[model samples]
Target: MERPYWVSLTSGYDRNEVLTDLMRQYGDDVWNFAFFLTRRFDAADDICQEVFIMAFKGLYSFRGESSVKSWLLTIARNKSLNYLKSAFIRKVTLLDKVIPRERASPSAEAVMFDRLESAELWDHVMQLPRKLKEVIILDYHYGMAIKEIAAMLQLSEGTVKSRMFRAKQRMSELLKEEREYGI
Candidate 1:
């Protein structure tokens, strides 16, 4: 895909306008990838903010070797890893909070979600190893090509393809096991 027009502007682009444009175009992708990596809703927000700030500041240095979205993802991945390693994060994270809190009653959206057969697959997807999970999310959830994923994750194309294969196999096994044992 061609780079965004903003990337080509040599001058006269207002800083806010460039930042706004980046957020408008790729904000959801960045946020979702952050959420996938960190697995904490709160951490994802912080990571996304940091990702955009860094992206905007470093936009000039962006070498165009990868898509801007992948570049943002690399930033998100770094921020997420830093967050995960922080002492505050370690102190604040606990098993109880990591387990999602249930609402007092289901909302319409939740009720509708309950009817989807594939919803449970997401839970299984979460159980995969981090490497496998990352590949699955980037490839399927974000619709990233193998080359994009490899670039984002700094893996070889063959490695990315292998992880994708293993991730799907593991998901199938998880579902089969759940059906057999009623997990």
Candidate 2:
């Protein structure tokens, strides 16, 4: 029997079923990556949707130059970075209006306490400088090989290795600080 049209497209054809399969195969992973990148649940949800839409639209450009995972991730990374850049700009603009608060509402305090206790140690991963954060997330969190990370980031293997070393050192310092403060 002939393969279904959607099956052929998701397997690399011009078929709608391919899009559904792609979503089923990658939706969760992409969402996780977006969540890690944005650190905001709502923004991550939006970016995840946008990433898949962009991927589906550009499906025809998948010239077999890279694996489907890599291609999808490239799109996601670009979209997320653009969002971060815009958010940074907005943060800069709103700096005068934003103020740190010491007192929290009861609900806010509870939420904060819960996050403090329940958050993973590595949740601090996002607090690192972007350069170090990238290496740590790609190497340790995502479990990408050093060479693979190097290629993905367009850096030399030695450079990625050095960045990983610095990221580890910074992470250790951050963890120690967290422990000392009981956070």
Top candidate when judged by TM-score against the true structure? 1
Per-residue error for 30 in candidate 2, Å, reads 1.6
Top candidate on lDDT is: 1
Q: What is the model-wide C-alpha lDDT for candidate 1?
A: 0.80
What would you estimate as the lDDT of candidate 2?
0.69
Per-residue lDDT tens digits for candidate 2, residues 1-183, read 112342224444644666677888877667666666765555667888998888778766556554566566667777778887896746843663586334344443236436775356556777887778878877765677888777777789999999999988988888898789977
- Please give, for residues 1-183, the per-residue lDDT of candidate 1 as tens digits: 444664565556666787787898888778877877777767777889999999878866777777777888889988988898888887678754777565587554345448867778877887998889999988877788999888888889999999999999999999899999999
Candidate 1: where are CA atoms >4 Å away? Answer: 1-3, 95-117
TM-scores vs. true structure, each candidate: 0.84, 0.72
State candidate 1's TM-score: 0.84
